[model samples]
Target: MPLRAEGLGKTFRSARGAAVRALDGIDLSIAPGEFVSILGPSGCGKSTLLAILAGLDKATQGAAVVGGKPVTAPLVDAGVMFQRDLLLDWHTCEDNILMQFKMRGQPTAPHRDRARELLALVGMESAAQRYPRELSGGMRQRVAICRALVHEPPLLFLDEPFGALDALTRENLNTELAALTAHSGATVVFVTHGIDEAVFLGDRAVVMSARPGRIIADVRIDLPHPRGAHIRELPEFTAYTARLRKLLAHDGRPDHREGVRP
Candidate 1:
């Protein structure tokens, strides 16, 4: 597994020092190069889980490991893309991508070429010199995606990366992202609230319940790879969407399906 969480749990402290459990007893694993999308209702600890796995935050209980190493701090081999682009307004797209190296105390020279290659890979080479302010929301997302992969990490975690884009742009980026994840050869743990997007992009969609979050099910996407927009029209895709919605709606309850559905 590229990523693994055993007996995972997390709790937050309020002003009055009350324990607010965000995640509980979560056990999940992702294989190398596998694209796993996490879907759930609001406050399910979906992003919280991603943050813990990326070592941006610590789990109050259990462990999260990436590439056989326990996640204590941010690991060099894992990359994370949050909801916002978080790109500096001053730098051009290329420099913003290269910033990944600079922030890590790494020499940018070695990673500059890779950054260009990734921008080109995402069809953003032309925007290399353009600042974040010069880019559209969708364009910024493309740049963000390239920046995340510039380091060539083996594992990537994303949290609602496309929630802000328009429908058409979001769909286009979904196509682009699906292709990117496949070609990057990196295991991806994507967190999204969109049921259709989850089924469309994930090899397996992990559905979680509400607060005190726990994995309710792992639904395999039976569709083929290199999937295009038309894939969502397929029976399997729609079926998975419906199933996930059903799961999220009835979450924190019994296993209505009786077992995990492939």
Candidate 2:
């Protein structure tokens, strides 16, 4: 169930009839049940690579394979979540989560039990009847996460899922997400701009270059899993963050959004 990319590249026809290369010769592999974070500057095509891997779009060149099968179109073997929760405005939390089941054509009875279990896992059983408008940003994101996992796909692609939350809530949710992934034993490909977040959650972190994107550095985070919040206070954490800062700053502009509070 590994995700593999070989000589992956992407291009687009611009409005003016010029070809623009977004990703360039990217090569990487993510093992089953591993957590890998892709970090880079805003326009570096990190999201583009993610889209190709999730089979949302076709790669202009090279290959991407998941679970030993070539990815042609959107594959059901993986799940994707983005920064926006994308919850239905009027649907109750549980109903919104159920939509995932409907999309995948999964049987209702088993997933119904699974959905309620996920809600309980996220400690949101109390809010199961609430609408998105009634929940706080953090709670809504939690519900979104529950929706993402309802189908129990082996691989999950998260594109800055915590990017919009407040500092405290984001930190708390990071802890929750790490624990949830551990319990589920699902492989993850997480995209983030926060070095601390990457260091905390990733088993391996892939840093990409500026436009005409390519992988520049691949650092393995040797930290033990169930990486508790307390680990952030240790020297290893500080050193790891400092190293990432140095790498991100190598090109004059760092790999991050300015004024990012999370």
Candidate 3:
């Protein structure tokens, strides 16, 4: 489904009763089946924007529309993944994914085969019976992805899902995610601080400014799909990353730039 944010703005009151603006005059449209990466400074409201788009939170002003309807509540057809795995410690890996179905009052048995297939896609099939406590950080995140995807939602939101992993693991999962989503025909909005990651995963990398975030640049990534790790070595990939870094550096404050590096 396509997503549209019209004149979107968000404001929050601080503990001392001060109004803090997070997003302002943000107008964005994401086409169906498009993977758009939102890159911005640390406090630039990236996560807040994702929340509004996913209908998890309401915009202080304007509206968030999905398909042809205005979003007023959490979308039943949307799936969300966060930096933390948020898996149940007592549940096994496969069970964690099945929990998604159970939460919706759906039958888990019908989805079991697909859940195993997703685990196999992430090379976690052997770990299906392993508890979250027994799995590594990356493994847990893999299960999180499966859980988010098992429902076959047309839209997926990921908020720095790989941000907490080690360098090598992060890269590996990035590649896997690219490959996994290539043919799934799902529209994805990925929010991240990593410039390379934004370039690597996004069809278009939308750069946002600091606090009271507004989009400053939207650069289309020209690289081919089904991108592997080797795609990162391409000159085009480097150029996209470089351009994003420069955009962030020019639009972001010195302290904010620290969170935007590759």
| Winning candidate number (lDDT) | 3
**What is the TM-score of candidate 3?**
0.95
Between candidates 1 and 3, name the one with more favorable TM-score. 3
Q: Is candidate 2 or candidate 3 better by TM-score?
A: 3
Model 2 weakest 10-residue run by lDDT: 249-258
- The number of the candidate with the highest TM-score is 3
Per-residue CA lDDT of candidate 3, range 1-262, in tens?
A: 9999999999998999999999998999999999999998888999999999999998999899999799999998898999998999999899999998899898899988999999999999998898999989999999999998999899999999999999899998999888877878899999998888899999999999999899999999989977889898999998998899999988754566577979
Cα RMSD, model 2: 5.4
Please give, for residues 1-262, the per-residue lDDT of candidate 2 as tens digits. 6999999999988999999889989999999999998899888998899999999988998988898887998977677899999999988998899888777686566667778888888788888888999988899999999988887778999999999998888887888889888887898999999899999999998998888788989999988778779878889888988898888877434547777888
Backbone clashes under 3 angstroms, per model: 0, 0, 0
> What C-alpha lDDT values do all the predictions have?
0.88, 0.88, 0.92
The whole-model C-alpha lDDT of candidate 3 against the native structure comes to 0.92
- Colliding residue pairs in candidate 3: none
